[model samples]
Target: MANRRASERRPSDRRASGLSSRRPSIDPWRLVPMDKTVHIGGSDDFNVLFIGAGNIMFGSDEGPWNHSFRFEHKLGRRLKVVALIDPAIERATAVLQKKCDSFVVSAYQDTRVFKTLEDFVKNMAPKDRPRAVIVGSPPMFRGSLAPGRDIEMQILKFFPGVAMFIEKPIATGPKSEIQDAFTIAKTIQDSKTICSVGYMLRYLKATQMMKHIIDENNLTVMATIARYACAYESIAKPDWWDKSKSAGPIVEQGTHFCDLSRYFGGEVDMSTVNAHSLEWDENAGALSKMAVDESKIAPENRIPRVTSATWKYDSGAVGSFTHVVSLQGTNYSCELEVYADGYMLKLVDPYVQPTLYIRKPGDDNEQMVRFPDDDPFFSEVSNLIDIIEDIEEDPEAAQILSSYEDAVRTYELTWAIREASERSREAAKLKAAAAA
Candidate 1:
């Protein structure tokens, strides 16, 4: 990373973590902090400094930087981020190299940000140190220490002063590896070194809005479908997306869907799934285009071009999600169609400003509801603040969304999808081999 060139580029003396204080320059669709209501624990109001780190595997360019910058630039007064990190610094000769700069964000992690996590903590001033240290990396990137030994030791060393913001599926390794990750995180019981996973999708405004509609109307999410399509070239990668390192598509890609399904449907049990390899898959011959995309993918990391499964939620809500990688017009695509008591809501394209269609029973068709766009960055930042402020007796269960353990459970559910897909593929391969 390049050194701070201009004096203006220097890190702000006082870093603010809580979004409640930030002054957003951008004219957001909906003015947040409009409530002027700040949620906190028993502790008094405090200024928060945030430090974030990452190890991006693929799409090294994407992570918490620019989005965060937008949060800071738009709301600089409330929450200012000090540093951003990842192995990307090794390539960039510049001091501040983030995934993108369009956000008008600044303060990328310089080279030698921290050789080890311990040293970073020690450098913090007695009071100037970060109130919360966001462990804000993608699922399978940028941790110096391996899971059990080094990772735990390093985190324990930092637990005293700083809180951590971990992204979802807490650890990427197998059962033993994940367990080790949990044990280490457990060491920091009541300290502010609170551990959090980034399950941002759960924070979507429409989701919150719909939950009310469902509850008030006594709606049952009868059956739902979640379709996610990304650039074909993007999904087929060697690192975290690869099945071996992060437990393949189920744990990697499918986990999000599983979590969403569980959110809408309650508990889910995978009833059936049919997965065949793009190369050897019987369906491959039928869908040449999809097969070509799958052909470029590694068997270990190859998410099925098509995966349809049935899930029974705890309340008898049946849900099914279909995930595929195919030619789609949008840069990225997601379609969530949920059915309930007397109406349905279709949420499309969550990353961008989300769009929703609300259809009440007996209506001629779906009615589009103008989305009251909410600033998600602040939502996430504010969420971290709450976690830091609430490190009391029982932390995990108290959180609004799923915590580390809940995220792990979601990962396990997705693991079922991955396993089912793999089995389907294997069965197809064996039959083909026998016939040949």
Candidate 2:
């Protein structure tokens, strides 16, 4: 970690736990003070900050999609993101040095890595503060700690009305804690901050064309089917398999489809949802075949290997989602198909190499659509920047596709599936007991 000037060091920097130690001074649900209706604007050079430095920032650089590198590419010299706040400063430094070069390295040459948000707030002057902040932290941060304060809430309490781009599955926790996090979302809304959730799929050109076709044709959607199957070997984090830490595959990985269901079918009714799952047993022969070490899997993180769920939207459109994690190697497949009157739309692999197929009435052929400009991760950050700059120019002109409030609906829908699956399991157990 680069050393900060003496004047930039504060008493708060001494905290042992680092970023997690910054408790919110304001009530989580209370709106923080906002001096202006337009918060971020009128700056030629943008000082962006990132809260968590992990795979999404570094590994993404050489992969199919990388948010940080794309962001720097779009802004060019106008961007000045010298420092990022993460408890693991050493990891951040290594990633930045390894993945980024030339201008990217020069920007952070004098970087001052703060161990905690508290230290940054106390040490940095107002002028050095960020005009925008990207939160790449895990969904687990949404869970409450010993003092009952969520890490997400702490960020909201500290940086009110600032342009924020938060990564998706906005939160992951117990039902009660999720409800609490949503309540704080209300505060974010009340503050009228320029906010965008990292539902980058929504920004894809193929997806945009799909939306345009649906709206322009005024097709009456009937039912939708979403399927996701992928080899989990590439995941950098073992916790990805754990339901408790990462919300399992449905809420964590399949969430893009859940959101797509709503995008095409309209809002879903939780009461209308039905779900089933096949639990994974480590002692089973399947584990031995896969060469998985049972000892490496955490007890609390145990989750079903396959889940199938169905639900009806408030619009009376039916939808089904199926997820399977039993595949091997790096082979993967993801598809969301919508059936509507006289037309069908299919979207594939929103994560990378996305493509869309449309079938029109009386056409034996399905037209394939691809976007050469479809770097969604690029558009995702650029869109936020445009929104922030626009709001600064005129608040009413800025409109973002996925806001915190909107993403919460998708989160709720995914949780409903998980909850319904559990209920089905309990019901099955009860029925077997009665028979015995």
Candidate with maximal lDDT: 2
How many backbone clashes does every candidate have? 18, 0
TM-score of 1: 0.69
Query: For residues 323-434, could you state the per-residue lDDT of candidate 1 as single tens digits?
Result: 6555543366777878865678888777676777898878868778655555454565555565555654644323446455556557656656666666776786799899
Error of 2 at 310 (Å): 0.6
Give the Cα lDDT of each candidate: 0.52, 0.69
TM-score of each: 0.69, 0.83
| Model number with the top TM-score | 2
Name the regions of candidate 1 deviating beyond 4 angstroms: 1-67, 70-112, 122-125, 141-153, 175-195, 233-241, 270-303, 328-330, 362-364, 386-400, 431-436
What lDDT does model 2 reach? 0.69
Cα misplacement distance, residue 63 of candidate 2 (Å) = 4.4
Deviation from native of the Cα of residue 36 in model 2, angstroms: 34
Cα deviation at 106, candidate 1, in Å, is 10
